[model samples]
Target chain A: MLIGRPSDITASEITPATVFRKRRALIKAAGLGTMMAWSGLSLGEEPKTKIQDYSKSSYGQEEKLTSYRDITTYNNFYEFGTGKEQPAENVGQFKTTPWTVSIEGEVLKPRKLGIEELMKLAPLEERIYRMRCVEGWSMVIPWVGIPLSSLVKLAQPTGNAKFVELISAADPATMPGVRAPILDWPYVEALRLDEAMHSLTILAVGLYGEILPAQNGAPVRLVVPWKYGFKGGKSIVRIRFVEKMPQTTWMRAAPREYGFYANVNPTVDHPRWSQASERRIGGNVFSRRTPTLMFNGYADQVAQLYAGMDLRKHF
Target chain B: MAPTSIAWIKRGIFLLALGPLIRLFWLGFTDQLGANPVEFIEHSTGTWALVALLLSLAVTPLRLLFNMGWLVSLRRMLGLFMFFYACLHFLAYLWLDHWFDWAGIGADIIKHPYVLVGFLALILSIPLAVTSTDAMIRKLKRRWKTLHLLAYPVAILGVLHYLWLVKKDISQPLIYALILFILLLIRLYYRLKLRRV
Candidate 1:
C-alpha cells in the first residue's frame, strides 16, 4: 500500500540543489550519530541502551543493527521477489489510500470500513515480538497496532462467529505476481474466535513508530505472533467472520502441507522440512539454532486451550 | 584411454561434486548465509538441486539439438550433482528441522502432499542414478530406458513441490514450469517425428 508523502515533499519544498544538499547533510548527520552512539558503548554497558528501544527489540539486544534501509526494505515475500530488499523496492506502486476492507459473511454489521475509520478504532501500541518465517529465518518486529479482537468485536459478529477469515488485496497491475495463479489471488487466513480474541493477535497499522513501510503490509495487516508469519496475511482488504472453517489461502492451495492450526511447534515437521528448530531472526550466523517451542514458546498461555485434541492428528 | 588419464577424469568429477559441500561449510562458518544457517543451507542446496536437475535434463536436448556428443559425458556428473544437492536438502530438513523426530517425519510423509511428491521424486531418481553407469546401463538394456523415464515425472514433482511450498508467490515456480514445459515439448516432438519415420 502506498503512503503518499506530504505536498511539501512531493510537490515543492525547495530548489533541487538545496534539496540535494539537505539530503546529503541529513545522511551525514545520521552516520555521525551512529558512530558517536557506538563509541559511547562500554564492554559492561547494557545492550538495550545501545540502540533505540524499538530497533533494539527487532535486532536482538546483542546483535548489531544492519543498515536501516536493509532492515526496513528487504523482506522474504517471494510473491514480490526473493531478495530481502525486493518488496520495499517493488511495492511502492501499490495504491493504498483509497483502500476499504470488506466485512462480510456471518457478521451482524456487515459494512466496509474505510482506512481512516479503521485507524481511529484503537490507539497504536508498539509490540516487540519474534517473527518466524516457514523458510527458517526470523526477525523481531516492533509492530504498532490494536488488538485484532477489538476490530472483530466492532463488526459485531453473530453467535456463529466461530472463525475469522482475512483476505489480502489483489491487483496485478501493482502486484505483478498476482498475474499467475500461484495462489487464489487475495491471500486468505483464518483464526478461531477464541484465538482471535487473544491479546497477541493484532491488526497492525504501523511499525518502528512510522506507518508501516509498504513492503511490510502498509496501511493494515494482521500479526499473529504465535503462528507462522504467513498466517498473518498482508496487504489485507477483507475480513469475514464465518460459522465453519473457511478455506484459508495456503491450506486451500495445499491442505496437506499447511494445516489449519499452523501453531509453531518443533514437533510438527513441514512435509518436506522439519519444525524441530528455527533460526532466531537477527541473530549472528553461527548463533546456535534453538529448539522451536510448542506454540512458538507461548505454550504456558495457549496450550491449555488445545488440551484434549491430539496435535499430531489435528496438524 | 590410458589408465592414468581415466583415473584423473574420475577424480575431477568427484572433486567438482565437492564444490557445493565446501561452499556450504564456508557459509556456515563465516555467518554470511543469513540469520538461519540451516535454512540458508537448505534453501541453497535445494536451489542447486533444481539447477542440477535442469542441467541434467538439458543434456539430452543439447546432445540432440546441437550434436555436441561431449555433452553426453557431463550427463552422469550433472545427474550425480542433482542427487548430492537433494541429499543435502533432505539432510538439512531432517537434522535441523526435524531433529530426528521420526514419528513426526513419518506422519508428515503420509499427510503432507508436497512432501510426498518431493520424497517420491527423490526416491524415483535413486535407481536412475545407481544404474547410470555404462556397465549397469548395458546390463539393464531396455529396462534402463523405462526406469530413466522417471526423470520426467521427477521434474514435474519437483516443480509441484516448489509451487506448494511458496505461500503466496508463484513467479519462480512458474518460470521453472515454463522451462520444463518447453523441454518436455521438445522431447515429445522428437518422439512423434521418429515414430512417423
Candidate 2:
C-alpha cells in the first residue's frame, strides 16, 4: 500500500511531432495505412505561439517536475489498453488529426469545432499542476491549455444547463481496450456547470512546450485538476451541456467506489483502499509517501464550488 | 527411496522454489520494476505466496492419485516457501507501507477487512512453518497430521485476501479463486472415494 513515487521518468522520450508524422507516413507507405493519424497528429500551429507557466506560491507544485516519461507512459487510458503501460505503447497510432469535438446539447450555439479552431480560441498557458490518481499514485505535471470557462463561454450554454458532460474517442478498431467491457466504451465524464466553468478547469491541448503526447490525451482533453484523474477523459470527442447531472463513467461502473464529485478528499476512501496518502511518482526508487491534499491542493480556487454540498456523498 | 535420490529430489525442488525471489532481484537490479516498485514487490511476493500455498495443497492429491510417495517430500519445502514469501509480503507492507507508524498501522488493521484477513493468514502461517521440522513431526505423529490440516482454512482465507483487494478487474483474483475451487473439489472427491472404500 505504501508505494514510493519516482523522481521524473527517463524511459523513451516522446516521439517528436515531425518524427511521429514521418513514421505514420512510413507505415502508410508500407501498406499499414490503417494505423494513420494516431498519437501525435498535429493541426497547424497558432501564429507566434508561446507557452507561459501559471506557477504560484500556494499551488501543489513539486520542486521537481515529474519526468515526462512517467507522466506520458504510466496512464489510465483504457481506450488504448488496460495495463498502466498499455496506453503508452498502444496509443502511438491513434488517429487524432481531422478530429472534431461536438459542443452540443443544451448550448445555444451548438457547433462542431475543428482541432485548429479549438487551439486558436484561447491562448494556451502552461499550468504546472499536481495530478492525483484514484489509484493513490500522484504526479506534478505542467499542462498547456486554455481555461474551460473560455470554452464554456464560446458554447453559450442555455440558462437551464446545470452540468457539462464530456465523452472521449473510443474506436474499437483502433482502441483495442474498447473490445473489453471495462466501463462502458467511449468513456464519459462530467462536471457540475459551475465546476466546468471554473477558471482552474482547462481544455489542455499540449504539455512540456508541445502538443500533448498521445498518451496524455492528444489534440484536446479536459483538465479538472481537483478531481481524480479518470474524471479528466482523454482524446475527447464530445462536450455536452445538460440540465440534469449526467452519469459519469466511473460512477456508472462502480457507484460505490466512484462518486460524481470525485473530489480529492482524504477522508472519503475508496472501498478497496485508503485515500489518506499517495505515492509521489518520479525520482528515487523508494520515493516517499505523503499525505494527499484536499482538492489536490486546489482548495483556494475550487472549494467555493462545493461550499454547501457534502463531498463524501457526492464522492 | 535411496539416500542419494532423496537428496537430489529435495535439493532440486529447493533451488527451483527460489524462482520468484531470483526474478524479483533481477527486475530490481535492472530497473524494470516499473512506475511503482513497492506495489510491484508487494503484489509479486503475495501472488507467489498464494501459488506456493496452492501448489503445496495439491501435493496430497498428487500423492494419492498417482500413488507417488516422493511428492510428499516436496510438500514441506513448498509449504515453507509459501511462508517465506508471505513473510516478505507482510514485511513489505509493514516496513515499506507503514514505516513503523504503530498507531496508524493498528488503525489500518482494524479499518480494512481485507488487511485483517491477510494479517491473520500471516500470523497463522507461523505455527505451521515452525512445526514443519522433522523432529516436530516425530514428536507429534498423529497430531502433526491433524494440525497441518489448518492449511485448508488458511488457503481459503488467503484466496479471500486476494479477491477483496482488487478494484475493477476481478479476473486476476478470480483465476486464483478458480484454481482454489478445483483443488478443493479434487480433495473432497478423493476423501469421499477413500471413505467409501
Candidate 3:
C-alpha cells in the first residue's frame, strides 16, 4: 500500500524560517534548550522541521533522547540510499503527499486508506524508543505516531492471518538506491500476527514532535522497538496479512546473515559483527559502548512475545 | 634524477602521505566527523590504508612502465605509510570500537570471516614492516626479495577485507578489487616479457 503525508497539512502551514529561528533563540535564552545547547557540541545547524502536537507517553521517559540532528541525519532508509548519511542527503525530492496504503490479504475489513485517514485513526503519541541497528549501533528516538495495533484492530484480521508483511515504497523517481540491486526493490519486513498486535509496535508518522522527514520514513513507517532497526520498514506502501510466514527483503538478500525474527538479542551475534554491545550514535569517540540489553531493554514488554522460541535458531 | 633532488621529493611525499591523518585530526577537532565519530575515524583510516597499499603496489608497475629506476626508492616509504594507516585502523577497531575488550575482540575475530581476513592481513604485514630498514634488507639479500613477495598476498587480503565487510552495494570494494587485479596483471605481463627476453 502507498501511504503519503497527511492531507491536512499544506505548504503554507510550515513555519517560516525567520519565526522558527526567533522561537529557537527564545527557547535558548529561556534556558529551555535541548541536548545540543547543554552539550556545547556543534552538530551543525538543526534542520527546519515541521512541528505537530503529540501527547507524550511514558515509553523511554527516563532515557536520554538522541539529538534531533543525529536522529534525522544518521538514517538507514536504503530506498533513499545505502549509506547512513545518504538518506538525509538524497531525500530532497522524495514526495510523501497524496500517498495511499492498501491493507489486504486475510483481513475481513481490508481497505485502502489515505495517509491522513491513518493518522486520524488514533491520537498521536510521542514514544521514546531505543532503536538498535543490526550493525551494532543504536539511538533513543522520541517518535510520534499511533500504535500499529490500532490499525490492525481497524482492519479486523481473519483468524487464519498468522503474519503481517510491511512493504516499503520503491519509486525510482525519488528513491535513487532502488535502481541498484543493493536490495530487492520495495523493501519488505514481517512480524508474527501477535507481535504485530503488540502495543509497543507503532506506525511512526513523525519524530522529535515534528512531521517525519523523508529520510526517517516520513508519513508512515513501522517502529518495532524490540527488533533490529531494519525490521521496521520505512516509507511503507502496503500491509499484507498472510497465513504463513512471509519472506522479507533482507532474508532474500542474505539469508544466513539476516533472519525472519531479527529480534535484538545480545547473546545471538550476527554472523559478521558482535551484537553484545552497541555504540550509541551520538556519543563521542571516547565514550564506552553501552551493553546491548535484552529486547533492547524492552524485555519486560516484549520478551513474552518470543517465550518458547529459541532466538538463536530463529536469528 | 639527482640524489639531492630525489631526497627533497621524498621529504615532500612524506608530508603529502601524512595528509589523511592530518585531515582526520582536523575533522575531529572541528567536530565535523558526524554522528558516529569512531566509525568515521575507523572508515577513514581503513580506506587510507587500502589506498596506500594500492599506491605502493603500483610503484613497481609504474616504475617498470616508465623505466624510472629512481621510483624504487619511494616504494619503501609508501609501503611503510600503508603499514602506518593499517596500524591506526586496527587501533581504531580495538581501542575505539571495542575499547580493548579482549574477549569481545577475540570473539569478533573468530566469528566474522571478514574480520578474520582483515586481522590476518594486518598480522602478516608485521614482518614486512619490521624488516623494512636498509640494514635488514642488505643482510637478507636474496631471501629478502622472496619474503617481500608477501606484499601481493597482503594487498589481495586488504581488498578482500573491504569486499567482504560491506552488506550490499559492493561498488566501492569492487573498484578496489579491480584496481588490485589490474596491478597484479601488469606485474604478470612484465614477468612474462622478461622470460621471453
* Candidate numbers sorted by DockQ from highest down: 3, 2, 1
Question: Candidate 3 on A1-315: residue-level lDDT in tens?
Answer: 232332332222334335556767877898776853533222223364554667989889888888776787788888877888788678767888988989999999989999989998899999999999998899999899998998899999999999999999999988898888788888999999999989999999988777888888987999999899999998998999999999999999999999999999999988888899999988887988999999999899888888899888998
Q: What is the C-alpha RMSD of each candidate to the true structure, in Å?
A: 9.0, 7.2, 6.3
For lDDT, candidate 2 versus 3, the one ahead is 3
lDDT per residue for candidate 1 within A7-75, as digits (tens), equals 212111212223343544676777876654433322111112111222222213443333233345447
Worst 10 residues of 3 chain A by lDDT: A3-12
lDDT for A208 (candidate 3): 74
Docking level for model 2: acceptable
Docking quality class, candidate 3: medium
lDDT of 2 by residue, A1-315 (tens): 222222222343344344554676688787755434432222211111234433233334544677666777788888877677777667645788899999999989999999888877777677788889998899888788888888899999999899999999988888878888976877999999999878889898877666787878887999988888888988998999999898888888888889888999988888777888898876344666899989998898888888898887878
DockQ of model 2 vs. true complex: 0.47
Q: Give the TM-score of candidate 2.
A: 0.87
TM-score per model (chain B): 0.89, 0.94, 0.98
Report the Cα interface RMSD of each model, rounded to 1 decimal: 8.1, 2.3, 5.4
Model 2: residue B111 alpha-carbon error in angstroms? 1.1
Kindly indicate the candidate among 2 and 3 with the higher TM-score: 3
Model 2 residue B112 CA deviation in Å: 1.5
Using TM-score as the measure, which candidate wins?
Answer: 3
1 or 2, which is superior by TM-score? 2
**C-alpha lDDT of residue A225 in model 2:** 86
lDDT of 1 at B117: 82
Fraction of native A-B contacts kept, per candidate: 0.28, 0.21, 0.72
